[model samples]
Target: MATIASQVVLHPTVSQSLKYGSTTLGRDKAYRAIQYFARFYAWYLLSKGDKDAAARWNALKTHLGTARKLLRLGKPMEHLQAALRACLSTGPAVEQVTTIARQISYFGYLTFDAFVWANSIKFWTLNPETSTRVAKISNRFWFAGILFSIVNGVTKSVRLARETKKLQSTQKWGEKTLAAEAERETRLSVLLAAQENTRHQLIIDLLDAWIPATALGITNLNEGALGIFGLITSLIAAQKQWEAVNGKK
Candidate 1:
């Protein structure tokens, strides 16, 4: 969906090892963040949606989300190419459409990375003053990214620990209390679900400045990150064999 990646190519970066290394670390952080979101969204959708939508997105949402985030960050196509290679290496016979999509998007991410980085370097190279301005802004953004991750990670860890403790305590109580608690939980979950969706829409609106329409993918509403890609590849392989037998019959 992104117009930029359509023309991007990723050559191996043996020339500038230091720059490449720093960039790779940044890319990895961004990739993991996206992957976490994707996996979460895929699981959320799978856990929340109808059977059919779940069937399509439940598996690869996490992986795809990572790909989407990396692409948005303007990471290199080499990373994406490697991911695609890894996904396809499992087997050509595998027919997971989502795997294929993830593979294609991986390529898409690479293309995006190459294009953005190439332009960024060129602009900076041709003009030191301009480069300095961009560099300053980029440094601030990078620092912000790191700070955001640290704060978010700590908050989430604490919240999860509390929620888990509550879940555990919920199991120790009497039936009447448990029933009332369960009903309260159901109400709270539903309310949280609505609030979450509303918050998510606001995020999508804000993200549009960075990601555009097409590259946003389906993550605006979904959940899983890692397991989906594996499921997709497995299912595709299974479906291919099924089709092969059906065609013969």
Candidate 2:
């Protein structure tokens, strides 16, 4: 019983985020981590002797499972947040518990964005030395895109941690402080939008204008395919951001 409780406390979902060094393989690992979190959370609940509490946890787990399925279905972040809210409503009704789950979920989202941008860079940077000027320029843009994404992810995670600390210290939230935090979050949102737009513009310039105008036009099939891939990925990302800003699912 003690061992089981220790395992519950030490589960990756309770505290784990992808590190910076191995981001190239992050997508696969993130998927595994999500799966493991779900499995362990399930096992933990089953190990509980309190039937009532286990029932509540089971319901929360169901919501989490729905969230995972919705994510796989390409649903927007709002849907995921809704599922998270359902889980939160079920139990452990503590602010600290809420903050940890919310932050970890956001971290997962950022990890995915990082994965896509990293792949974009990899594809763009292939054969960089022998690539045409257009390809080279696109690679630079991809680098900026990935860099901004990493910064955004890290900063948001840090902000969450700081807020959690403040919540713990205060032991309660005040309206004035909540308002200030909301405003700060809004500013961060604007920064994210600006950086994303800049990256999108660079991608458009490369794919629509620069590539066509360059004398060495798409020297190989692979480069063309990768460029198209990057464009699609960027467009999808931009669309999701727009949806988020508009408060849509």
Model 2 vs truth, CA RMSD: 21.1
Per-residue alpha-carbon lDDT of candidate 2 for residues 1-249, written as tens digits (9 for 90 to 100): 999998988775443322321332333323333443433444455556555665664555445434443344332355357546656564323433443444444444444433343343464343434344434444344344343434444444455555545544653444557787777667656655655554554454344333223323433433234334434544444444444434445
Looking at candidate 2, what is the lDDT of residue 212?
26
lDDT of each: 0.43, 0.44
lDDT of 1 by residue, 30-118 (tens): 34444444454556665765667655553454444435444456443553565566565753232233334434444443454433444
TM-score, prediction 1? 0.27
Q: Which ranges in model 1 have alpha carbons more than 4 Å from their true place?
A: 1-125, 176-249
Candidate 2: where is the Cα deviation over 4 Å? 1-131, 172-246
